[model samples]
Target: MPNPSSAVSRRTLVTAIGATAAAIATAPAAHAAAPSTTAAPSTPAPAAPGTQAARTVTVPATRARSAAGRAAAGVRTDFPIQYVGVSWDGPRRGGAIRLHHEETGPGSWQPIATGCAGGPDVAGTAAKAAPVSAALVPAGGAVGYDLRLPDGATNLRSTALDTTTGPARTTTLSPTTPVTFCGVEYLSRAAWGADESKRFKNGVENSPAKYYPLQTLTVHHTDTPNADPDPAATVRAIYEYHAITNDWGDIGYHFLIDEAGRIYEGRWSGDDGIPGHDANGNAVTAFHTAGFNSGNLGVALLGTLVNQEPTAKARRSLALVLALAARTHGLDPQAHVTFVNPVNGVTKPVDLISGHRDWLATDCPGGIMYGTLPALRAEVAAL
Candidate 1:
């Protein structure tokens, strides 16, 4: 005779086991069975081959459900979904990497690997074929890596990651001008500031000042040559002349460059670097320019070039100075500004580079050198 209680218990056990087996077979590999706390019948049942059975017979159903939710949300795997690699395929070396994304959340990407050659270790080892790993990037973001050259300098290279599929962008950098050739320390505004107050000539001084967000750079040429012939003496003489003859607090121009292409500082204002003084009994502005004195930077060369042609060294120095001035002022080199000839009333689309004659009544920068202004600007643009 079959016991009635035993028969009921057997039926319940069979139903539960069938349901669990079906779930295990159909669910994804990421999902695994969770333990349950409810008591089972006296005779425990066996599951299919390769299936893991619940070890502890006391897990809450709520906990199992929470774990399943996390697994479906991709929380079970710690490995990154994307990877990055760097390589130098000849002409396609340094550039920035742009990452595009389909979603709009806070996302970022990082380098998991790098392909670089010999140099000092940075972020890690700096040898050829050495792999470097970076911290994980947030979703929808990018990172940049500067590859080291054999000479132990860095070049631009970038990588980006996107959780969603999107196109990548790259920006190549042009060769940089050597800091020494540019006449001032590269990227050091403070260094340039401290060097301005020294005298270049008996009466002239080079006083450095901050730029005041002005858009125009007024160019000029010093008409006299001191017997000293030394660049520092030339700058000193100009400062003294301006202070004594012109009765100004400092030099008129913001910068002065000697024929050797060395930059000297002139004038001082707060960090804006443009020359300005008090008004009232200070009623008159500094004599840097006549009409545009309020919003222009005056830069004077050390010697007269009206009759002589500017040398290659002088031209390069001027271009660098102009480029630096334009960048500091946030002026666009490519954007053309209108220059209406004060005498003829004819207007020309002048490049951001301008002459002293444009603002004041002087043959500043002279006829011979001024003719080459267009070419000079083109050279700087290439840089």
Candidate 2:
């Protein structure tokens, strides 16, 4: 009624002031609720200790089967089954077969009749025997066994049945197939003496003639498994290695034995009946042992013993080799061989079957193979 314009202006001013107050209040509240642009306080969960994750694994079937089979057979499952040799009694009619056992630790030889089958010779029987296993025979070791036939027999024929392959191995024996070792026909001195000169002379050419009075017969394992397992080839390779790699004239050892227990002539040819010499003023000594190379006759067996054992034929050949060496050296075959440790110069009375490690710092024959030395020597004594 007094002035409408003035009244409206006053009202608008009151409304504007109210709106400004409200905006100020809301801005403070929003600022308090929002996080600051600066770094926020860390709240990390505790970390786990440094550790590897768990894993699952599977074993091979052969190993598992062997373990189960051994457990059921009452034999220790941990040790590998090594076929040492087969034993058989011979007769004109037939023979009984048995397989000789060699356990992993130091133990006496045990016989297992489960794996063997009747065969012409122990090898044929062993080849056909169940389990279908094989072993490396160190030089001068036996690789087979002979069982006497029952009375009233003229000839024997037998075989081995391999359990793994289910195959039969058979051999027929005759008078013409004479027992041989190292590829050289094994004949009595009387029978083969006439060819000694030719054979002995041939041995000399295998290496330069180096002579030393044979004082010791040292045993060794080749450490390498022969791929071909041939005694002749094995000897040849050894000679070449010595001549080429070692810069020696020929194979250091005088003799070598294959898995079959067959012996092969090395540096000193069995034909020549002479010993070898080295470039270092040592006799053409066998290089079986590292430090004891000068006065020792090294006989290397062509196989490793990590998971395998020496064959029975190899064992027999080893015994025969030792016998020959002992006879040649004039050492008592029944007495222990003297081994002088090259490191400490400590002397030990090793059996006539001393090992390469017995005289050197290195493990020449390996643990399992060397472990059987005592038994080997005893067997040699009996032989």
Candidate 3:
């Protein structure tokens, strides 16, 4: 459906009965820098000419019993890596284990940031065990991972994920064609291994995905680990947790931006969805806000921003995404706009690019990240 926001003459965008939206809303106008400017190795490859679709390979698990009886396992993947997550049977405790990775052979092992196995609190999935945070490894490189445990850490496991080289050359928009928005390239669901997203338990689903007219863009942070070795893996784990554990059926954000400035498609969108608009035209509706989700698009950074700021790459990518949203939706990035939650009949005034806190009384997109929204808006406006 054409987003009511985009279809200005159509009836005001409404969700449920008694919902009211403004009429004659005027269209308005609308990052960080990153180091090395290289795309994530697992940055979903765009479909190319004469190339087969990107394929997925699940590296076999390697497990060992330490001399002290602590469990340790490591696996290496040959293809470009996208997402990574771990499974362990245990309770939350003080002792910590480190998951390290080498971008290439014979290099120093760097620790990949991790989180609980159950997913992060920001997403509202309850934790079941202490699992390592997954990584979205940047740029296609020969990557290897090693899980190191102290004497007592046990019940540990890790998996290596490699997504498609890129999106399929053919989409509903074109056959053997390339697609891009703003100044950034987008990875398709297949590029990020959405097929690997954890399935809903018992095949049960929550309410069907909702749709709304594109209006506003909501910025968020996954609140997972920031120093991810393979952020794609962390994203996959989030997809799984949101689907299986939280029963949300899919990851909550419409797009995910890693520290490396890689943009991964979030919350699968169908063929009919709008390419540049928000949730309503985008096919996939998400749960990033409580009362106001339908018309808003969510672009989430990969890590916590409550204290620390996003990587330069992340900031740059966010600006591009918001620029696309603003231009496509006729929104002015620097202007404050009023939005009506079609679902709840509630209204809120927020910047075209808003922090999660603006919608709810929660510390979302983090205080540090939220504070940067003004600067981010300026970047979008410039774009």
Candidate 4:
């Protein structure tokens, strides 16, 4: 496992001082009492010179249904789905809900994901229904799940989705080809079924476009269901959540990646479907990291990965995007970078490519994936 302490120390430098140069300059006292050995590693092995084959893959759409019962709720489908997720509208009684799936036998199902209901948000934020999801390594032919419910619960309606189509690339990823040259689907808001009126109730003109020089690239996990059947719907749901629930006026990330490695353009850039560029000719900024939103590009992988690993296609696509970003921004993928957020003017010294956890006090990008950063950077460098 990757060490969180190292990440904590690195983040402490920026978080302790706030977003001002004056705060940073006057915060020597914050570091004076710290141990001298609390720093990230100085050097890492360089990636070997090599070329990977180019490939193409597609994730099939998912279908879903729901029902109420004490026994398993089996929803059959036409094909096998590699992932599954459940959104329940059960009785609002908070309790531990156990979720599981099986290949061929009854009661032989394996536990995949867990979620709790009725718990108060530490900040006492507004209450909302909790959704849970799980990834299936060996895609199942049918979709059927059972929920171990607590006593006196009723009206258990669930939105269960199964994706029969697993990710399979039609072309291999060649080290020489940048992802920009690859077939990236730059879907407009309508393509993903986003209601512009819902997102901008005050009127489109009220929420003007915001831009900043794109600097560091930060990766994050949606922290939602990775087993979504329809990636587009998942994207739309997130848009609503971010715009309405979080009141951010837009999806926070600049780009979204599905489990099959498909990339979607996020956060309206006002350049039609083309990516917006800054006056200096760099890519425009996105609202991904809070204090680091300015001058940064956020690319979020669409799944929670606290204990599970991302799919191979997802990782490859991530490398391709990161490489393209490095090439576009004149960055060395393996080099250390210093970024000053245009929003708060706070600075962070980080890897040319970094995880969201590196910038904030949160479990983002997850542990399994975060540990792969060094290798990911090396792969980008090679590309």
- How far out, in Å, is residue 336 in model 1? 3.3
Model 1's TM-score against the true structure: 0.40
Model 3, position 89: C-alpha lDDT score: 43
Clashes of each: 39, 44, 32, 15
TM-score of each candidate structure, all chains considered together: 0.40, 0.42, 0.57, 0.54
Q: Local distance difference test, per candidate?
A: 0.37, 0.39, 0.53, 0.51
Runs of candidate 3 with Cα error greater than 4 angstroms are 1-183, 196-207, 272-283
The ten-residue window of minimal lDDT in model 2 covers 29-38
Output the lDDT of residue 56, model 4.
28
Score candidate 2 by lDDT: 0.39
Better of 2 and 3 by TM-score: 3
- Of 1 and 2, the candidate ranking higher by TM-score: 2
Give the Cα-based TM-score of candidate 4 against the true structure. Answer: 0.54
Say what the RMSD of model 1 is.
Answer: 36.2
Off by over 4 Å in 4: 1-185, 204-207, 276-280
Off by over 4 Å in 1: 1-183, 186-211, 226-228, 271-286, 338-351
Encode model 3's per-residue lDDT on 1-383: one tens digit a residue.
Answer: 22344442122211210121111112221121211211323323566776644433332121111111222255555444444444444432333323333533544444543331222122233212223322222323335445553344466654444433433222121221123332235555544445432433455544355556667889988877668765665666566555543445677788888887777777755553234233343324575665566677888898889899998767877777776666545668888888765555556778878988787645668889988888899877876
